[model samples]
Target chain A: MTEKDLIDACKRKNRQAQRLLYDRFSPVMMGVCRRYIKDPMEAEDVLVEGFFKVLTKIGMYNGDGSFEGWIRRIIINEALMHLRKNNQFKYAEEINPNLDYTEEPTVLDEIAAEEILNLLDEMPPGYRAVFNLYVVEGYKHREIADELGISINTSKSQLILAKQRMEELVKKRLGRHEI
Target chain B: MKTEKNISTLFQKGAERISVQPSGQAWQRLESRLEKEERRGRVVVMRWVASAAAMLVLVAAIWLWSASMQQHNFAILDAAPPQNLEDLENVDGCEPYCLVLKARAELPAYYANPVEKRN
Candidate 1:
């Protein structure tokens, strides 16, 4: 059945429909979960909780943007929740916004997803979380600020610094002349 | 199929994604939760009903109490009360009244006040 068809059936609370919906979305949502967190088990746990929240709040999905976007948001929140539960969010002192990261766009495209995740793993929990959330999910600075309990300026400066740090590491890993 | 394929690759790189196996366990748990929720719904309704009943009883009791108090007050007003004869005769001599003598009773007392008594 088409996704819309499945969603319609799920809205009616059909058991088969609910199960089918979960099967289709869980894997990708799980991937999204893993990005901000390290442990597979905890990521899976968040995925389950996120999926449950989505199921309960599905009626709130107004079909304005994307259904995937809606679910992606729930998974991101779940990851943040897990981070908070484990006391893993590290809030760095605010960096000066003037720090230059002009060439990050080209540098970012060159790095593999795996290497990025590795650098993310090494990041202080707070910085890594803000970085992944802003860069990967395309969340706005205001959004990161609101979610992470930091200011918009803080989010921007952090993203800039995270990119600068990630670039340095990627250059170190790939050697300077390769790119 | 590029979009679908991209999604598949992204998922594959992360780990083996759990193919959603429809375990009866999931349904069973859902059913139990829903049942519990249903029970909670009933309990909420029952609570509202109980509150409404309590409010109604309180209103009724207050109404009866006020009505009884009004009736008692009316009874006091409807029956007679003692008034000073001097004042009573001086103003309006409308009702028969009696008072115990404060001192020795004088045989007969009569007066015609020329000035209006300031009430």
Candidate 2:
């Protein structure tokens, strides 16, 4: 069915349409959730809850923006909520001014997507959240601060820490591949 | 040496390209949750409907009780004899006794005035 038809069927609470929508969006949404939530099981839980919300609250979508974008926002919010509920953001505001940025610049183009996700998973939860928000999601520092309830400077610092950590991880992975 | 912008672009592109198939049971779990929520919603609506019906019954009962009381009061007033000056004067000093006298006045003629009937 067309996206419009699928959405209309979902609005009518058609079960089959809801299943098709889930099949279409869950993979991408799961990937989005996994970036913020480290545990695979927890990420899947968040994904399920997000899709449930989408199917149930489908009536609120006024067709103003891209449907996928709207769904992505809801899933992202759910992942953020899971983090907040677990007090994961408690230590996210700590500014690590002593973080080392000294590293040999390495080529990042050859790294696979799965390897990138692994790099994200290796980072601390706070750094991962900030990095995914600022880098992947294209959110401004101010918006990231508001979403994660941290100050703008904290958001900026977290991004720097996350980047340095990701670079280190990438370098480590490249060294292993070269060996 | 990749620039900071290049790293950001790489991560963003990687994220966009990434899509992992969820576990096979993911859909089943979500379907069950949706059904549970639907059942919960139905229960909530039923509770609201029951509460409204109960309120309607309570209001109707109150209305009927008050209406019956008004009718009984009017019947008593109609059957009782006209108030006398003595009964009206005694009302302030002995309101309850006056009310009792008013009720006694509704008795049969043979039992009407205890003092005069005995004589």
Candidate 3:
């Protein structure tokens, strides 16, 4: 069925439509939730909350843009809310973009999910949350500020620090000697 | 190195992307919960409507009763204008019933219009 048709059916509170929606996008959204939260269990919990919010707030989606994008934004907000409750935001006033830059190789070519999780697991909670929000989730600094209730400058600096930390972890795993 | 290539793979996790949803029992529980919530919502709405209707009926009944009371009061006033207005005004300590000599006096032109003069 078309995306609009599915959206309409869901709006009508049809179970089949809801199931189809879950089947189609749960994995993608779960992947997003998992990145922000290190615990798979917690990620699943966030996904559930996000799904419930989407169902209740479906009326607000006006079909002006991509439906998936709308849902994705909701899921991202769900994750951020959970983190905010836990006091997991990292704030740095200004980030030297150069300081966060790392001359590292791409690990995506061969790294497994377990390996990536392992690298993520090593970081502290605040760093982990910021890293997932900035790089993995693709939220801009202003958007992150609004979501996390922090300043834009802080968002940029935190992202820079997160990248600097992630760079070291990825390099250590990949065992690369030179830049 | 500083290439943006690995970012996609980091997020996607490729074929490992799997979803775990609730079981049949859990889904049934959720459905039951939702059903209860919907029923509660309906009851609340019904109660509000019923209360509003009752208030409307009460206001209409009170208004109708008040109008009837006013009409009755007006009837009583019309039925016995003389008794109720008895001695309402006294001229020289006498009830103004001139025929019985209670207050017989020369009437002024305004009070005794020529058209109403008793010949």
**Against the true structure, whose lDDT is highest?**
2
How much does candidate 1 score in TM-score? 0.60
Off by over 4 Å in 1: A104-113, A174-179, B1-119
Docking class of 2: acceptable
**Largest DockQ belongs to which candidate?**
2
Rank the models by lDDT, top first: 2, 3, 1
Output the better candidate (1/2) by lDDT. Answer: 2
Deviation of model 3 at B53, angstroms: 1.9
All candidates in order of DockQ, best leading = 2, 3, 1
For residues B18-117, could you state the per-residue lDDT of candidate 2 as single tens digits? 7888999999999999999999999999999999999999999999999999999899668865456384673445677677776666666646555554
- Please provide, for model 1 over B15-82, each residue's C-alpha lDDT reduced to its tens digit, 9 standing for 90 to 100: 32322223334445544554565578789999999999999999999999999999998996797654
lDDT of 1 by residue, A74-123 (tens): 87888998898899866667788777646433222134556545655666
DockQ per model, Cα: 0.04, 0.26, 0.14
Candidate 2 local lDDT, A1-179, one digit each (tens): 89999999999989999999999999999989988898999999999999999999999999999999999999999999999998887454556646665544455455577887888888888888988988888999999989988878788788887787887777776662321
List native contact recovery per candidate, as a fraction of 1: 0.02, 0.52, 0.12
Question: Which residues of candidate 2, in runs, are more than 4 Å off?
Answer: A90-105, A176-179, B1-5, B54-119
Candidate 3's residue-wise lDDT over B1-119, tens digit each?
54345543454444234334443343344345546756887899999999999999999999999999999989966774343334445644334444444333334544666566586
